[model samples]
Target: MPRPRTAPSRRRRIAVDHGAPLVVAKRLALVGAGTSLRPADPNRAYYPLGVALERGFVTDEQHQAGIAYTRAFAVGLRRPLALGIASDQAEVSDERRAELTIAWRLYSAALAAMSRRIKDDTDNLVLYERWPLWLLPGHVEHEADQRHRKRVKLGLDVLIAVEPKIGLAIRETRERRGA
Candidate 1:
C-alpha cells in the first residue's frame, strides 16, 4: 500500500501565508485619479511627476531647478551614450563616435513613431513623462515598454502601484461607509 500525496486546494486551508516582501527594493506612492483628483496638494511643486522615486509635487519646472519638463521629451531625443563620448585624455575613437552619432540620429528618427503619445506634455498629471535623460533609445528596446512607462508616468496605468494606496483607500472607505 502506498500513501497518496495531498496538496492544499480550494477545500484545504494552509497555516502559512505568502505575503509581499518584508522590505521592498523601492518604496512606492499612489498617484492620480483618486486622491489627486479630490484636492490640489501643495507638495506637488517639489518633484517631477514622472522621474525619480523621491516625493514632491511639481506645479512648476525649470532646467536649473533640476525639475521640470526635461524628462518629458525622453521619447523624442537621441539615445545619448557613455562609451563613445569624446574625452580630454583620449577623444573617443572616431569610428565609435561616428557609429554612436549615426545611431543617435536613427534613434531620434525612431522616436517619431511613438512621439505623439510618449512626448506629450499634457499627458503628465501625477508624474512627469519618462522623457529625456531618464531614458535612452537603444538601451531600451521594444515599443511596448516605452508605452508602459508612459502609462506609469501618467499614473494612469497601475493606479498608484505602491503601499500608500492603503491609506487613501481606507479614507475613501470611511467616507463611503460614513463610519
Candidate 2:
C-alpha cells in the first residue's frame, strides 16, 4: 500500500513597525485589498475578507465591523447593497460613483488607522491575545489561502502604483535603511 503524503510546513512571523509610515501604508493596502467586497464563490464563500479572517490577518470582530461599514456606506448612498457587483462592479450615476469613491477612501483611511492601533499596541499584548487559531500546529495551507495572499500582494502593487506620494515615501525609507 502507498503511504499518505504529508503537507510541507510553513513557518512565518508577523512583524509591524509602529513608527514607519511606509509600513502603515503597506498594511492599509493589505487591509483594503483583503476587505474588498468581492463576489463570493464556492472556493471563496467570503472572498477576500473571509480569507483575511481565516488567515489570522484580522479578527472576527474586525471582519464583521468591515461588513457593517460597507453596508452602511451603500445605504447612505441610497444603493441596494448586493453582494460582489453591488460594491465592486455596480453601475451608477456619476454622482453615485463619486460618493462610492469617497466612501471607499474613508474606509481605507479607517483601515490605516486600525493598522496603526495594532502596531502601537506595544508589549505584543494585542498580538498575543488575538493570535489566530488557524496558525496553530497541524494547520495546513490551502490553495485558496495562497490565492488570497497573491491577491493582497497585487492590491499592494496597485496601491503603490497609484499613490506616487506613498511610493516615494517607501523609496525614501528604503534608501535611509540602506535596503
Candidate 3:
C-alpha cells in the first residue's frame, strides 16, 4: 500500500537568517515567466514558493507578505489602488478587456489571501506552463515528463536564472559554507 501524500503540519519553523520562526520574517518574489496576471491554478503557482520556503531559502513571513503584496498588486486592496492600475492600463476601446483584467486581479487577490494563511505545498507557490506555447509538446505525457525534468533541473535553470534577480540570496547561500 502507498502512503497518502500530504503537506507538512503547521508549526513555528525557525528561519536561519533572522532567528525568528520562519513563519514570521517577511518578503517574497514571484517568478512568472514575466507573467503579470494571477494564475488560474494557484497550486501550480505556489509550488516554487513552497520549496524555497521549506528549504530555508526565504523566511515564511516574508513569503506571506510577499504573496499578499503580489495579490494586492494584482487586484488592488484599496479602491484607489485598484482604480489607479486599472485606469493606467485602460484605453477608450479596451474598456471591456480592462474590466476583465480587473476581475482577474480580484480573483488573484482572493487566492493569495487564502494561500497565505496556510503552511504546506499548496501554500507555497509557482505557476509555469510545462513549455511555452512556442514549444508545445507533442503530447500531454511528453509535457508531464518535461515539467518533471524542469522541476529536477530547477537548480541549474531557475535557480541560476534567479541569481541575477536574487543575487543577494545567491551570495548569502554561498557564504554559508557548505560541504
Candidate 4:
C-alpha cells in the first residue's frame, strides 16, 4: 500500500531584499500577478508580457527580464499555489483586472493572426496596422479615425521593436541547422 499525498505547509515563499530598489518589488509583484492570473494553457503564460510590450507598459528589456523572473517564480510553485495566492492573499484591484482583460484580448488577436499564417513581416505589418478595424469593427470606423490610427500605431510599434529579437532567433536556428 502507498501513502497518500499531502499539501505543503507553504504554497509559495520569497525572500525580501530591503536594500534593493523599489522597482525590484514592483517587478516581482507584476510577475507574481501575471503568473497567478495566467490561463490554463502553459504555452500562453508569456502572453501578458507581449501585451505589456504592445501597450508600452513595459519596455522590451523589462519584458525580457520579467520573462526570466516570471518563469523562475513559477518553477518554485506547487499546483495549488496559485489558488491560495489568488483567494487568500493577493488583492487584485479592478484596474489590474481590466489590464489583464486587455492583455488577453491582444494575445487572442495575435493567436488568430498566427493561425491565419500571418507570421511574415509583410503580413505582420498589415495585421498590426489594420487589426483594430477587423477585430473591433464596432469601435473603429475608417482606418484614418484617430482611435483606429492610435491602435494601429501602437501595434506596429510593438511589432517593430520585437522584430529584431525574432530575427535573431531565426538566425540562431538556421546556424544550428547548418552546423
Candidate 5:
C-alpha cells in the first residue's frame, strides 16, 4: 500500500529584515518567466482599504471605519447606468435614495475631518481618496514608506472620531450576514 502524502505547509521560515508574514507558497508573476519562489508581497493589496488592514497598521475599529467610509463614498457617488439599447435611467427606491443621502453626509463629514486633521499635508487627503484605485503590485519598501502608513492611520483615526458607529454598524451587518 502506498503511503498518503501530506499537504505542504503554507509558511516557510526565511530570514527577512522586516516582520512580514508569508502567505503564498509559490506563484508565477508572469506567464513565461522562470523565477525562484517568493513569499507574498506585504505591500500589495487588492480589496478596498485592505493594505492598511493586512499590514497591521490599523486597529479593527479603525479598519472597519475606513471600510465604511469608502463604501459611503461609493454609495454617494453611484449613478444609474444606461445599458446597451436601454437609455432609460433606472429608478431607485425611496429608501435607497434616503440611504444615498445618508451615505453622502457620512462621506462628506469623514472626508472633512480627515482633511482638517491633516491640513498640513493636503496630499494625504488625496492619497486617502484615491487609495481604492491604487495600482496593484506596488512595492511598499520599509522605512521609505513609513510616512504613508502613518498618514493612513491618521485618516482612519479621524474617521473613528467623526463616526464611531460606522464600525459598529459594519460589525453588526457582517454578523447578520454570517460573514
Candidate 6:
C-alpha cells in the first residue's frame, strides 16, 4: 500500500555561532523580529538578505539599492481602494503621484537593463525576486550557484546604476573603511 505523505515543517534547524564576525555556517546575527516572533524556536530563524550579505554575494550598497527598488515598486503599484471609499478622497497630491510614476519608471528601466545583462531565466528571477544567494549544505560549490552569484553581481550593478546616490554612499563608505 502507498504510504500517506505528511506536510513538511515550515521551520528548519540551522547552526548559528554568536561570536563569529562572519556568518559562515555558524552565526546567530541574522534573526529578525518576524523570525523570532514565530512559535518555533528563534534560533531556527534566518534572514535571507543577511545571509547573502555575509556570504559576500551582494554588497551593502546593492542591498540598500534593492531595498529602495522594493519601496519604489510598492509605491508605484496602485492599491485597491477600501470598500465605500470615494476615489477623490483617496487621491494623493500631484507631486506625490509624479514621484510614484518616476519611481516605477526607474524600476522598469533597470529591469530591462538587468534582463539584457542576465540572459538566463533563472538568473533573472534570482536577480529580481529570489534571494539569499548562498544556501546551506553543499549547494554553494555547484556551477549553477556560482553562475547565479555572478548574475546577481551584474544585476546589482544595474540596480546601483538606477540609484546613483547609493553608489556614491558606498564609495564613501569604502573610503572611510580604507578598503
Expressed as tens digits, the lDDT of each residue in 1-179 for candidate 6 is 99767567644557575754454324433332223333222333243443455444566787666555544444445432221122433466554444555665665566676675453432333323444334443354768877766776676567667666444544564576566
Q: Give the winner by lDDT.
A: 6
Q: Global CA lDDT of candidate 2, please? A: 0.43
In order, candidate lDDTs are 0.33, 0.43, 0.36, 0.39, 0.46, 0.50
Off by over 4 Å in 4: 1-144
Residue pairs in candidate 2 whose N, alpha carbon or C atoms collide under 3 angstroms = none
Q: What 10-residue stretch in candidate 6 is worst by lDDT?
A: 80-89
Model 1 accuracy (lDDT, Cα):
0.33
Candidate 3's displacement at residue 11, Å, is 50
For model 6, which pairs clash? Answer: 17-26, 17-27
Tally clashing residue pairs in candidate 4.
0
Q: How do the residues 9-68 of candidate 5 rate in per-residue lDDT, one tens digit apiece?
A: 645567665523333221112111222553334333433244444444456687676555
- Candidate structures ordered by lDDT, highest first: 6, 5, 2, 4, 3, 1
Off by over 4 Å in 1: 1-90, 117-179
Model 5, which residues run further than 4 Å from truth? Answer: 1-45, 79-92, 114-144, 164-179
TM-score of 6: 0.49
TM-score of 5: 0.44
| lDDT (tens digit, per residue) of candidate 4 on 106-125 | 43355345443323322232
Counting clashing residue pairs in each candidate, in order, gives 13, 0, 13, 0, 0, 2
The TM-score leader among the candidates is: 6
TM per candidate comes to: 0.24, 0.27, 0.21, 0.24, 0.44, 0.49
* Residue range 1-179, candidate 1, lDDT tens digits: 89676865744666664443421212122222224434333233233352222222322232211221122122113322221211221344444334334433332233334454532432343223334322331344467755555543443222222223434544564566565
| Worst-scoring 10-residue span by lDDT in model 4 | 76-85
If candidate 1 were superposed on the true structure by all CA atoms, what would the RMSD be?
23.3
